[model samples]
Target: MVPLKKYPNYSSWAFLAVMAVGALFCSTVIAGVTGQFNLAPVGIFCGLLWVIGGALCFWAVQAEQDLAGTGLRSMSVSILLSFFSGVVIFQEPTLLYFSVPAIACMVIGIWIPASKTKSVWKNWRSLLSGAIFGTYLIPYKFSSLGDMEFLFPFSVGVCVGSVLLVAIMTLKRKKSFGYPKIPTLFAFASGILWMLGTLAIFWAIADDGMFGYAVGYPLLQLNLVVNQMWGVFVFGEYASRHGRIKLTLSTIVILVGAVLLTLSKM
Candidate 1:
């Protein structure tokens, strides 16, 4: 794979294509090995939602180039929606005293970094992406199929949706598809990594697992801390003193909220 410096020049379509291909391959192999090919309608819908949400997230990342900020925005929304799903849809009991303030902290934390970016449209993309991601799992919760069983249909949706999106965008732009080898390899690797993470989350939320959607979902949002570390140490994002301060404060607040959410499960 090419160095990260070459990323800006690579075609997004090619990136999406290779990533989807990689994820599709992993999902197909997993489903085949597990012999769990039950294609519930809700599973298909969940897959479609994942593709669209993932595309939006990629777009937002391209636009902002600030992993921490985009991650915070999207994951914040995901956390909020998952909390709502837990309480309302699943009837999971949450201590309102903890959850209400947790939500407030997350909302405020998400808002703090908004002023860092000039493009409101980019922020909207992140929010919309997160919203879709948050709700996509709801369909999976409704599906009768087991987590591994649903992966095949969901991966198929991802591939199909990605292809359609690429085709539409290519036609609109009147450009031939460009496949840079290094970027394609990196993208493919990313997809594989994503599939692994998805599997972990699926198990976490499965009925047989340790944590249900309410608890497991929010727990995953702790990735925001890792995102921030990459942004600060690797990318040199939030270089300004003021920006650093805001980022620190917001991260602390977000962590507090996440911790509170976990405790609410207790």
Candidate 2:
């Protein structure tokens, strides 16, 4: 945990900037190496949406202390929304028998952790963040470029968005942009890591990839499992027996839902 209080003067925008810079660098490198440098308007749009959504996600993470809750709320919502978008808008096959219950379990999982939180504003932010993260990939569906090819434009959008954020914050707060060195490095590393994961996701959902949008998208939400593990073991979250029980139960239910979703596509 980067002691939030220790850096009273740290700017969130500064952190976001470094992270975006890292992502930009990674994406540029990958695109160059793969020779996948096709640009499209939709890709740019996806990047812009990611900027807003990613910012909200960063804020939600900072505001919410429970890492599991943060992952569950945002990711569950993202899975549900993206699943439906794949089915309804993209005209993907509908496996109601499995999907209905899967959705129910996910909703239950989201509700359990969400009910524990006292901050209404934080809840709203998490929900909004999930909404954006969920739908930002829609434009990719329409683009003619390969998954790897879309990364460069998408990263450019992220960089542009970061710059806009820094400018806005500087002007509004009347303060220069600044951040602690360690946090900046961590943020940059995180961006590189995120870009790597994002590449896999893009490949998974690509038209020629192993899984199409409906299947690949929901399967990726399994990341919540890893997120929860960090919360429980590393962060010592849900230390109380009751909290642990709820976390375990919710996670099981969510996983069950995810399993059913996987089967639904078969």
Candidate 3:
């Protein structure tokens, strides 16, 4: 097993990521036979494939040994999250929710990291994917299908999952590639946690979009911000570059922005 302390170089991580993609392709091929047209199967399948890919990736660069505890935990969490999503169905939105702050949440949820990490706008790619995810949980042509309000939860789950994965992968990647480094993958897991919870939020929103936005979004975002601050949950951010004081200030600002959003929505 590769020691966590001994970072694996970027080339090795990239190899694993590429292999993960191939695994995704392989899973996609397998998913074709399944009667379901939803992306849930593919997404859940990809989660496993990433694990296999990560393991293979690990083996390729390091010695032949089982993956580490943290890696195993991460995979387990992802699997559980996807499994939870698979059982639930996405419904249409019944309430009205949309505005600048909502847009800001969506943007910051995806953008902040995009700028700091790799591609800032890359989260948008998951729009279709997230929609697919939402569709699976929700019945087709539901009464509120035209509302599109519930898209927030679905999209957040997708956006967070996509970017956070990239972030975590980078954290584990060794320094050979020269990309900015994170000390550990522990924090990145928070993103996964929030994503998992979002699955519920999407399903809930499908039932009642307003509550989902006013209640659900705030709960989720608050949890997320807390995780970001704690640095123990998934994708937690520290105040290194921004500094502790600055981070605190930013949190307050975001909270205020979130409150404004809640008020506007209400």
Ten consecutive residues with minimal summed lDDT in candidate 3?
64-73
The whole-model C-alpha lDDT of candidate 3 against the native structure comes to 0.36
lDDT for each candidate structure: 0.77, 0.77, 0.36
Encode model 1's per-residue lDDT on 1-266: one tens digit a residue. 12232486676666776788888888878887888776567766787788788877777777766677788788888988987897789877667798778777876876676674376664798889889878788878876778888788887778778888898998999986777777777888877777878888889888776668877787787777787777777778888899888888888887788778667767
TM-score between model 3 and native? 0.34
CA RMSD, predictions in order: 2.6, 2.4, 13.3
Candidate 3: tens digits of C-alpha lDDT, residues 93-119: 222244345435433442232224433
- Which candidate, 1 or 3, has the higher lDDT? 1
Models 1 onward score TM values of 0.89, 0.90, 0.34
Please, what's the RMSD in Å of model 2? Answer: 2.4
TM-score of 1: 0.89
* Candidate 2's TM-score: 0.90
RMSD of 1: 2.6
Q: Candidate 1 — worst ten consecutive residues by lDDT sum?
A: 1-10
101-213: candidate 2 lDDT, tens digit per residue: 98788768756655443865656767788888888998898778888778888888888888888888889989787776877787788788988988898998887876677
